[model samples]
Target: MGRSKDVLIYIDRRNCDFFQNISDKFQVIFGLNNFWLAKFFIKTKYILFVLVNIISFYNNNENGLVNAVVAIFFATVYLVKFCQKCEIMEKMYEKGYNLFNENLILCRLNRGLFFVLLVLFCGMGSALICLNGLTFFVCTHMLLAFCIVLIICAEYFYACTPRPKGKSKVKLLFQKIQKKIEKIISPEPVPDSC
Candidate 1:
């Protein structure tokens, strides 16, 4: 498994770099305030899930308490992992979450959309299951399955898209040219004059 992961990481290094760039931008825009709010949203979402489960506990006939507990457990673990990943991004940049004012609004908007989806899906699935019979149950199950597949696809696309080789080579050459120009224009550092 570890070997496979390493190979996957190697294959997707470019996408990983792009993802890191987006994460850096998100940290700048959302800063600590929106990030913390996102955390709160996650917690509240979980609480809402638990409350729904409790309300429907007596009515559950299929997966029952077992499924509810498992779902909540997985969701909580994912939330913690998400926060840790965000923290690592901040550490990588040597800055707090609030580096770019322009990004803050975007970050908030992105997270808000995510929270809305999470609640809509989880809450609706839980409620629908208790209110009806086989049709509702199957529909909720399919919807949840679709949601999981969508998330998997999004992750893969973000982590595995490769740049065309010729385009990448040209981009590198232009970057080198830009660096050379900067070196020529900048004042030289004087040794032992710090």
Candidate 2:
């Protein structure tokens, strides 16, 4: 009984550490310094749109691909504008200005966009749940929804938690992978001959 309790505690601790590591990596990837957040949003939305269109096509719905392309284009434009506004706000904050008063309109617009995204995600999740009877739909759609929720939760945790000291494990792993790729891609020089 004692051994089982110890094993359970170890597992719980490991899970917490894993979550913290994920949260840290999420923060670094989506840090507010540049366009990472914008890129993330754009990519995620585009992928989701594509997935939805694929599902529609499988269901014999015409015009799904065209609609997906149109939606992605508009979403990309909106996300770019939103990212610009966020950058402006960050600049204002850095300059010691009151963000709320200085960027009232932009803030409102951001809030509106956020709510729209929230509603869209919720609707998609509901649609997936409704189609849960289908094996393929349940596997793909629900997995996508789970990933989206996990990302959101990670971001939220990152915002609430203080930055951990030392380099992130994810960053180190990426750096190692990058170095290996570079070594593979850059061929060694041949000896001088003739």
The candidate that achieves the highest lDDT relative to the unseen native structure: 2
Model 2, span 58-162: residue lDDT tens: 664577667656755775686566556556545554576653333333333333344345656667757777865665554555545543554443232222232
Per-model root-mean-square deviation over C-alphas: 16.3, 11.5
Off by over 4 Å in 1: 1-32, 92-194
> How many angstroms is residue 31 displaced in model 1 relative to the true structure, after the best TM-score fit?
9.7
Across 1-194, the per-residue lDDT of candidate 1 in tens digits comes to 99975765464454435555554444444433223433444555556555555544546857677877887688779767756644554353344333443333234334335445656766666676777775545455445544443443234222221221233344567789999999999998889966
The TM-score values for the models, in the order shown, are 0.36, 0.41
Model 2 TM-score relative to the real fold: 0.41
Model 2: worst 10 consecutive residues (lDDT sum): 153-162
Over 4 Å off in model 2, which ranges? 1-42, 54-61, 100-194
